[model samples]
Target: MDAQLIAFTGVSAGLVAMPGADFTVVVRNALVSRRAGIACALGIGAGLLVHVALAVVGITAVLAAVPALFRALQVVGGVYVLYLGVQTLRQPHSPVGNPQGGPTARPLRQGFVTNALNPKVSVTFVSVLPQFVPAGAPALPRTLLLALIMVAVALVWFQVVALLVDRLGRWLRRPRVARGVTAVTGAALTVFGSALLAGPLRALLRAL
Candidate 1:
């Protein structure tokens, strides 16, 4: 493998592994059921594919160019994330197999929406990924190849996280433990979402 490719792969792995909304969502759903966890992982993979397609076609570049549009997207993403966090916090603790269901009930869609709305992913594609593509290289093929590598890495990592969470299901699914986990993840999402919204919101308030 080319040195740059290797470096890109390492960087991608590190980025995907970072604990963020995706990680929290996966863990929360994984606590519900292994199937749900895997489903969520697959959904995240699909979201990554969408981002890759958009980035490769230069749509993300357009978003980057339009500050207002990008900030609008960031605000939307933040609100969505904040909503999810509030919903999570409000969720009543239920048994692992409760038929009433939760986000885990549609883990795939939840995961997809969570990831798809994240502007940071688009930014990464627009900014970080391009650095790895050699100048004057056949941009299309090379970029696709690199994107595939990133998607694969992310899928594998999340799947492993889900599997591991499943392995610890016995303990994590307990009433008290599950409630604690829920609280932590919910709070995390809230904070993350707030941070995302902070800058744009401040700008908006200033303009007003």
Candidate 2:
């Protein structure tokens, strides 16, 4: 509806899906097991749908109540995002029970849960959407439309990323740098989480 709103949503989606914890998840899935990569990608997409729906309800409810409630969500979401980053260092390397990069094996449920369980998704839906959705907009339908836009962005972007990774599978298998790559990915996830946490932590400090 508003240009600022669209820009905010675009920025949030970009940041959320970029080479942070979520991107790490996709790459890890792709590099490890092909089907799982796709599965995880699909899971992430599905998770967006769920999060947007929940966010619409949550945002609407909060809108009806205290104005300050939105900031509170931002603080909590920042903390949650940081927690996810910490998890990157120890992020599970399990192959999604799928055969190595094979089409026959797909862990759809696992993919769904992995993305669904991510706190950052909720943060996107809750804290991020409210900043963009014009107040008093047709609430339900508008939220759904915005959510669909988000989902389309995720599906298109992530699926391409997965395919790109697949094409470069050989390079990733290089002997000298594979372990190093894994270690770096873990560190990156932690950094992403830490960076996200920084903003809210600063907000919290200012509030004091």
Candidate 3:
């Protein structure tokens, strides 16, 4: 593989490995149940496919061109994430190692929505993926191929995280530890959402 491709792989892997909203979500679900964790990971992959589809179809460009529309999406996504954080914080701690294995539907939907609504994902695909595409290559196919690679990398990383959490279920299930995990994850989500909103909020203030 060429240097660019290698760089792309390294970058994508690094990004996937880094703890972020998706990581937090997956870990949270894993603490609940192995099934929930797997479901959440798959949901995130599915959501990424949606982003790839949009980027391939040129919606990314449209969003970039329309500042107001992009800002509106940012605001909505930010609010949704913030709400999720608050909801997580309010959930009472339960016995560790005794996962509820929540219905598959909830985590799946939550993962999909959380990932799909993230503008950063869209921006990354639109702006970064193209850099690795070879000149004269069919842009659409190349972008799709790159998206698949990213999705694969993300799935593997998330699954590993799920497995680790499952193995540590005993420790994670302790009341104090579980509460601490929940609180930290909740705070991280809130901070992430607030950071996302800051840009749009500032722009709106300037406009006013």
The lDDT of each candidate is 0.86, 0.61, 0.83
lDDT of 3 at 190: 82
List runs of model 1 lying over 4 Å from the truth: 98-105
* Predicted structure with the largest lDDT when compared to the true one: 1
Which residue pairs collide, candidate 3? 96-173
TM-score-superior candidate, 2 or 3: 3
The order of the candidates by TM-score, greatest first, is: 3, 1, 2
Superposing all C-alpha atoms, what RMSD in Å does each candidate have to the true structure? 2.3, 5.8, 1.7
Model 2 misplaced stretches (Cα beyond 4 Å):
1-9, 59-111, 134-136, 190-208
Measured with C-alpha atoms, the lDDT of residue 14 in candidate 3 is 90
Candidate 3 lDDT (Cα, 0 to 1): 0.83
Name model 3 segments beyond 4 Å from true.
1-3, 92-97
Q: Cα deviation of 134 in candidate 3 (Å)? A: 1.0
In candidate 3 the C-alpha lDDT for residue 48 amounts to 90
Error of model 1, residue 151, in angstroms: 0.8
